[model samples]
Target chain A: MDQFTLNLIVVGATFALYFGIAIWARAGSTAEFYAAGGGVHPIANGMATGADWMSAASFISMAGIIAFGGYDTSAYLMGWTGGYVLLAMLLAPYLRKFGKFTVPEFVGDRFYSGTARVIAVICLLIISITYVIGQMSGVGVAFSRFLEVSNDTGLYIGAAVVFAYAVLGGMKGITYTQVAQYVVLIIAYTIPAIFISLNLTGNPIPGLGLFSNDTASGVPLLTTLNGMLADLGFASYTEQHDTTLNMFLFTMSLMIGTAGLPHVIVRFFTVPKVADARSSAGWALVFIALLYLTAPAVGAMARINLINTMYPNGVKETPVARADVPDWVANWEKTGLLKFDDKNGDGLINYTSSAETNELDVNKDIIVLANPEIAQLPSWVIALVAAGGLAAALSTAAGLLMAISSAVSHDLIKGQLNPGISEKGELLAARVSMAVAIGVATWLGLNPPGFAAQTVALAFGLAASSIFPVLMMGIFSKRINSKGAISGMLVGLIFTVVYIFLHKGWFFIASTASYSDSAPMLFGIKSTAIGSIGALLNFAVAFIVSNATEDTPAEVQELVESIRIPKGAGAATGH
Target chain B: MADKSSSNAYWKANIRAIQIFLVIWFVCSFGFGILLRPMLAGIKIGGTDLGFWFAQQGSILVFLVIIFAYAAKMNKLDREHGVEE
Candidate 1:
């Protein structure tokens, strides 16, 4: 059978599985719609969170980013995973005990302020919407490449699939479907890494293979890679190039941001108990670590493979003739993601760090998707990658959509707009809002904003600076009044947005930026790393404002005390 | 139900434990991985040093252990405080 048939069959089979899970898990009530009826097993919730957390970026682009950035990019690895530590210890258990349908519900009730909730809803919407656009675009890219369709058609199909599951089943359906997605994405990610690891280091476990000896060079894999990169005028693979302060602050920002993300935090509310929330976080990390641990190995090995492919004999020897290049090169070249130019008219492709002399131009994003082909793996594996990328994108898009809809239907419409709305009416509203969210995400994805590439910084910066600090202060300190919470969130939100806009363009218009990232304005900290400072400002402002104001209400103090204990979580409270 | 005093103690104990674990978390990821990396570069692992290992794989593994261990300890504390459901 042809590759296209195999691609269709594999991708079709996965879609069928997701649809089956969605059909089986149709939600009937608001509780089921928002928090999976408040009875999800810890391990299942963990798996679902893993799938939700690891987006198309993690599956498709992370290894490539690490591959090219080398040691300077360890921030991505540590920052992403280390946040679960913050979640497990500082936030998850307490939030689970609070037992609310949405993050804004918790914020509103905890602070005893509608304004606080509204601010949270706004922050959640901005963060989730910006994040979801990337996932939608990823879905489009995967579909266009594998199914041979236009990007718009791919996005529409992706939006339709997400709409069907997310609207019909809500969080319950998304939770189960995400579990299946986790399995598909992890297996698809690991198999190629395992094959490559064995080929490179004679070790089957990719994580261990990274530290093991290179089978060809009889040295540590990293050592061999570092040597080759240095010889090619590239920075050493294992040496740090970025400043220490920026790395520290960047990692801190990502950690807090991960914990603050409403989509991730809401996953904890699905578990039955607070203790489950804690262990479930551990389980989620274990699953996430499975992919993360393999990523560096895949990255280092891919760099080596690319170098070897370019210099068939050795780096010092004659480069391969352009006409004699591998079929994988030709295949990828058609997509415009990889290009070969005979710069000196010698017809030999020169891959190097020097821009002027380089004859091969490669997009780092293609590293993971093209790995199997580059390594000469079978067509079935390539097809599985296509399915895996879709699963990663769809699962995250669904999770973000759930967060968006719940904030609108539960927090905004039910909590504020119409407190008397019936549960059935609320459910209908949730479905409608979910469909609308998906539609908006698809449209934004089709016509991605100028700042689409920097959405990560924006989403993380907002979450870290605004949402996380407020949530932490809400749970950890009873002195903080509604006024303090509102001001802190606004201050953090405004500071972060302005800082990012100043560096990235005013409202990301590209021409209105007051400063450039190459030369940052404050303490040598780039805008992406400014969230840590912004979070500090939030905490400080909250402390001062709350101290200056009257103490929290006695009832609100009791509410805070109640969330501290895990004894009476009961069922998640609805409006 | 536990009295208010003992419940407050349970909360205090939880805070203390979280503080200790967070210190360890900070040390592993930020300290060993970044700030103190140059100081610890003398200790080699594979082709890199202890700091690089911490930045890449070691700190992640430590994070896993810290989370599970904290959970177990918190669960036991919950039971001891008579707060477990």
Candidate 2:
């Protein structure tokens, strides 16, 4: 059979599986809609969280970023996974114990303030919406490439699929579907890495393969890669080029941000016990680590493969004739992700670090998607990759949609707008909000703003700077009153947003920025790394405001004390 | 359920444990993986040094261990404090 048929069959099969799970797991109540009826097994919840957490960026773009960025991008690996540490220790268990349903519910109840809850709802909306746009766009890209459709058509299909599952089944359906997605995405991710690793280093395990000898050169894979890159005027593969402070802060931001993200935190609420919440985080990391560990190896190997393919004989030898370029290059060039201009009219493809002399311009996003094709992997494997990418995008989109809709329906509409709304009415509201959220995400994906690229940093920054600190302070400090929480969130939100806008154009409009990232306004700290500073400011501000204001209510103090321990958690369920 | 003082002690113990683990977490990722990396460059691993290993793989593995260890310890604390559900 042809590749297109295989692609359709594999992708279709995965969709069928997801739809089946969604039908089997349709949510019957608000409790199930919001927290999977608070009875999810720890391991299953962990798997669902893994799928929820690893977005299209993790599946399609992260390895590519690591491949090109080399050691500098380790921040993403450590930052993303390390946040689970913070979640497991500092956030997850306590939240699970305190949990009724949504994150804003905690903020509202813990602070004893409607304003704080509304602020949290706003922050949750901004973060989830911005984050979901990227996932929607990723779905479009995957569909366009594999299914041979326009980007718009791809996005619409993706939106429809997400709408069907998310709106119908809510968290329960999303949870089970996410488990299947985790399996698909991980298998799809690791199988290619395994094959590539064995080919490059004679090791089947890609993580260890990275440290093993390259089969061709009889030296460490990284060593060979570094030597080749250096010979080609590129930085060493294993050496750090970015500044220590920026890398440190960026990692810190991602860690906190990951811990703060509403969707990820809400996953813990699904588990039956606070103890399960803690261990579930560990299991989530184990599942996430499966992909994270394999990523660096895939990145390094793909880089080596690219150079080898281009050089054929060696880096010092004649480059491949333009006419003789690999079929993978042609295939990717058609997608406009890989370009060759044959500079100097020499008809030779010169892949190098020097910009002026380079004849190939490969988008970093294509590295993983094109890896199988580049290495001449079978058609079925490539088709599986397409399905995997879609699963990654769809699962994350569903999770983010869940967070968005719950914030609107549960936190905003039910909590504030109409406290008297019945459970059935609330469920209807949740589905409507979910559908609306997906529609907005689809529209944004179709007409992605110029800042679409910066949304990851923005989402992470807002979460790290605003949501995370407040949640932590809410749990860890009873002295913090509602006033303190509100002010801290606002200050952090404004500071991080302004800092980012100044560097990335005011509101992401190119002409309005007074400062550029190349010459940052403060201490050479890139806007991306400023979230940690914002977090610190938030912590400091909260302490100051709380000390100056009235102390927390006695009953609120009791609530804080209750969440710290893991007892009577079952009694804490549902409003 | 335990009385307030006993619960307070459990909370205190939990805080102490968290402090210790967070210190380890910071040391592994930010210290060995970044700032202290130059100091650990003398110790070689594969083609790169130990610091590179920490940045890429070692720190993640350490994070995994820390989380699971914390969970186990916290579970024990929960049971000892008579707080386990």
Candidate 3:
């Protein structure tokens, strides 16, 4: 069968599986809807969190980012994975012990303020909504490339698919579906890596294959990669290009942001026990590491493969004629993601990072999606990749949609505005909020703020600056009053948003920024890395404000004490 | 009975464990991976420097070990303090 037909079949099969799980595990109560009745096994929850956490950016674009950025991109790997250490040890168990349905509930009850709850709900919405936009656009890109649909139609379809399952299943449905997604995505990701690895290095394991000798070049993969990069006037693959300070802060921000993201944190609540929450984080990291470990290898190998394909006779030889450019380049050219210009009128491709001599301007997003095709892998593997991309985008979109809707319904409406609302009423509100959130996200996806990975990084920045510090202080410091927590969140959120807007454009409007990351940075910190500074400011503001205000009530201190001990942890079903 | 003083001790012990693990986490990802990467450049692992390996793979491996260790150790601590759920 044709490749498109095969892709449809595989992607369709996965969707059918998700919908089936959604139907089977339809949520019956608020407990089931919010926390999957807290009955999920540690391993199962781990797998689900893996799928939930590894969003479209991780699956579709991360390797591509690493491929181009080289060692500078390691921040993403270390930052994201290391955050789970923070989660497992610092946050997850205590939050699970708090035994609430939503993150805002914990924030509000712990702070003993309705205003804090509302603020927490707003912050959750912002983070989740910003996050889901990336997922929606990711689905759009995957569909536009694979299924041959327009970006708009693809986004709508993705939103609809997520709405059907997420609204029907809630956390219970999302939990099982995410587990299935993890399996499908991991298989899809690793298979292509394995094939390419074997073809390039004669090693089956991509991670091991990365360090092994390149059979084609008769040298270490990294050595060959650096040599080729030098020949093309690009930075060496092993060398760091980004400023050390920016890299440090960016990595730190991403780490804290990963811990702060509401969707990932909410997944811990689905487990059966506080102990389960701890172990589940470990298991989740194990599952995540399978992909994270493979990513660097995939990035390094794909970079080498692309260069090899371009310079078939080696970097010293004349470049391939523009007419002889591969079919993958031709296909990507139609999408405007791959542009070739014979600047010197040589009619030959001289691919270089230098603007003057550069022939190919390749969008980083295309590297992973087109890697299989570029490597001449079989049609089935290509189809499975399409399925995997959809699984990653859809599963993350579902998770974020759940978080957004719950914050609106459970935290805002039920917890604040209409405390007397019945469970059925709240569930209806949840579904309504999901539909609305998906609609907003779909519209934004149609006009995406930036590349999937870059857009997601902005969401990470917001989470890092705002949510993480407040949550940490709430659990760890009994002295922090509601005023302090609220002030900290506001300061962090405003500072991060303004800093990002200054560089990325005012609310992502193009060409609005006066200064770039290249020079005139705030303390030599790029906007992407500024979130760490904001987080520190948050901590400072909170402490200063807390000390000036009235001390915490004795009862609230007791509540903090109870959470820390983790004894007499109540059921997730309990209010 | 879970007295206030005993619970306080348990919390302090847990804090100590957290502090220790966080130090390792910081050293692996930030220290080895970024700031001190230049210092570790001489040490080679596989095809790359120690810093690159740590940044890409080693830090993640260490994170896994930390989480599991914290969980197991804390669970044991909980039992010892009669705070086990």
lDDT of 3 by residue, A285-363 (tens): 9999999999999999989888877787898898888888788779889989888888899888888778887888888
- Name the regions of candidate 1 deviating beyond 4 angstroms: none
Per-model CA lDDT versus the true structure = 0.92, 0.92, 0.88
- For model 2, the stretches where C-alpha displacement exceeds 4 angstroms are none
Q: Note the residue pairs that clash in candidate 1.
A: none
Model 3 alpha-carbon miss at residue A497, Å: 1.9
Candidate that beats the other on lDDT, 2 or 3, i.e. the better one = 2
Off by over 4 Å in 3: A449-455
Q: What pairs collide in candidate 3?
A: none
Among these predicted structures, which one has the highest DockQ? 2
What digit string (tens of lDDT, one per residue) describes model 2 on residues A188-300?
89888999999999999999999999989899999999999988999988888888888999999999999999999999999988999999999999999999999999999
Which lDDT tens digits does candidate 1 get at residues A201-316? 99999999988999998999898888888788988888888777788899999999999999999999999899999999999999999999999888899998999999999888
For each of the candidates, give the backbone clash count.
Answer: 0, 0, 0
TM-score for chain A in each prediction: 0.99, 0.99, 0.97
State residue A399's C-alpha deviation in candidate 1, in Å: 0.2
Candidate that beats the other on DockQ, 1 or 2, i.e. the better one: 2
CAPRI band for model 1: high
RMSD of each: 0.9, 0.9, 1.6
Name the 10 consecutive residues with the lowest summed lDDT in model 1 chain A. A566-575
For all the models shown, what interface RMSD does each have? 0.9, 0.8, 1.2
